[model samples]
Target: MSLYQTSPAVAEALAQGRPVVALESTIITHGMPWPQNLEMARTVEQTVRDAGAEPATIAVMDGTLYIGLTDDQLVALAQAQNVAKLSRADLAACMAMGGTGATTVAATMIAAAQAGIAVFATGGIGGVHKGAELSFDISADLPELAQTPVNVVAAGAKAILDIPKTLEVLETQGVPVIAVGQDALPAFWSRESGIKAPLRMDQPAQIAKAFAMRRALGLPGGQLIANPVPEADEIPADVMLPYITQATAEAEAKGITGKSVTPFLLQRIFELTDGRSLKTNIALVLNNARLAAQIAQELSALP
Candidate 1:
């Protein structure tokens, strides 16, 4: 792998042993519309800062991996058409070929671990898509988390996926799923998945200690801190189920699959909910960012 050049701000933070939270880039390019996406990207980064850490949002431009983007780059990327969505399988290819790409959760984790940033914040992790039993359409995120040593804070698996199966896969792969301040695993956009988390940690310091212990034990995989969305911001599982079913059915009817499926489903859900989903999504991501920053701070305190 080519040496990744960390941004000046991120480099200094790492050198000083200050907390740094890594962020994925697909949310900016594939998850939202232009101006709003750019605004949300900046807001998420600022939230991490407000919570006492620097945010390092990862992406690729002309094959160079960037730890953080300048304002102009963020805006241009948000509005740019035809950007590649990079994941574990394709990340190296993009960098090697000198192509611009947005980092997904899997790619972000790889970059974060390489940069020595132990914590990452994202809206949600991808998982076993519905009908994966037949389609075999699982996300690379599972294996990425199974090997990379980053502490990922997310609202849980995206609501569009099969939550139980996703949890099962994570368990089988030996990744820790620790719920923050809750017993039930959270479903993105909703506060409850009605499934209890395998592990629970109420304090960021406790979670940080867990990561430390994992390293001490020579564990290979990372940890997934499943932080639930704030109650006021949640859509509730019941209220969201029918909408998700309808959106999934529509996607199937249109034969949208693979990389196109997620964006299509999210857009359909946004239209179906009159943009409430997007609003809830933004809230959940910011909440996750705040929690990730706190965890990063805690981790930084470790020897």
Candidate 2:
């Protein structure tokens, strides 16, 4: 039996060798609430379509991994509660148990590669959390990128993570961190992280060529393309830092750890920012979707 199913649209696109961008379902299941999550999902997918690539929004429903969700399945996943957030560690177990779950970056990349999709877009990749020395709480995303052959487009690591340390980890793993059109990496809700990005590319085609070259060289992993949010939509690193600090402190104080840390900090930051952070999150995600689509288009055109 097949372990997964592709939506008709995604199957057609793959068969035709058209560009298809992989999108994660965690944003719908764990990143936002209700109608807004559904709306963001729809908007992000449409943004990819407008930019000339098919969007494959991946998830697992009742043990069946889905490469792309239809509208009804999208709505159902958006509305589903207590959904398991599946990462590399738990994705197989969730599937084995006949469970419903949303794919995190690691799981999404695995699913995308399985479906033969080459690019993925998300708000931000998880990274080495603050105070990770004692907790050892690095995200599986870093390791996944070192092995998965999919280009992941994001604003950057979440602003709340230890950005410098995150970069250190990515470098150690031999993953390319390419910031688009900038010298600095973006910090999720903010457009700048104040640290220099290791590499920079100015255009989608530039990124696409690098991706293809990596494959030609028989490289094992994908590159990370840090696509900054639109300037008008960014919260500005300086403006966002204090709120992030406060929220991180609150999470640490309240004993929030592991997978729960990100959600907890984000909610607290959302409240502290008077909901501005959420707006920025949505904007960055849409921006990443657009870039991922263009990159995918360029990739599809490659020999």
lDDT of each: 0.93, 0.94
Per-residue lDDT of 1-303 in model 2, one digit per residue for the tens? 887999999999999999999999999999888998999899999999999999999999999999999999999999998899999999999999999999999999999998889999999999999889999999999999999999999999999999999999999999999999999998998778999999999999999999899999999999999999999999988898889888988887899989999989898999999999999899899889999999999999998
Best by TM-score: 2
- Name the Cα RMSD for model 1: 1.0
Query: What does candidate 2 score in Cα RMSD to the true structure?
Result: 0.7
- lDDT tens per residue, model 1, 163-226: 9999999999999999989899999999899999999999999999999999999999899999
Q: Tell me, what's the RMSD of every candidate?
A: 1.0, 0.7
Model 2: ten consecutive residues of lowest lDDT: 244-253
Q: What overall lDDT, based on C-alpha atoms, would model 2 receive against the true structure?
A: 0.94
Q: Residue 7 lDDT in model 2?
A: 98
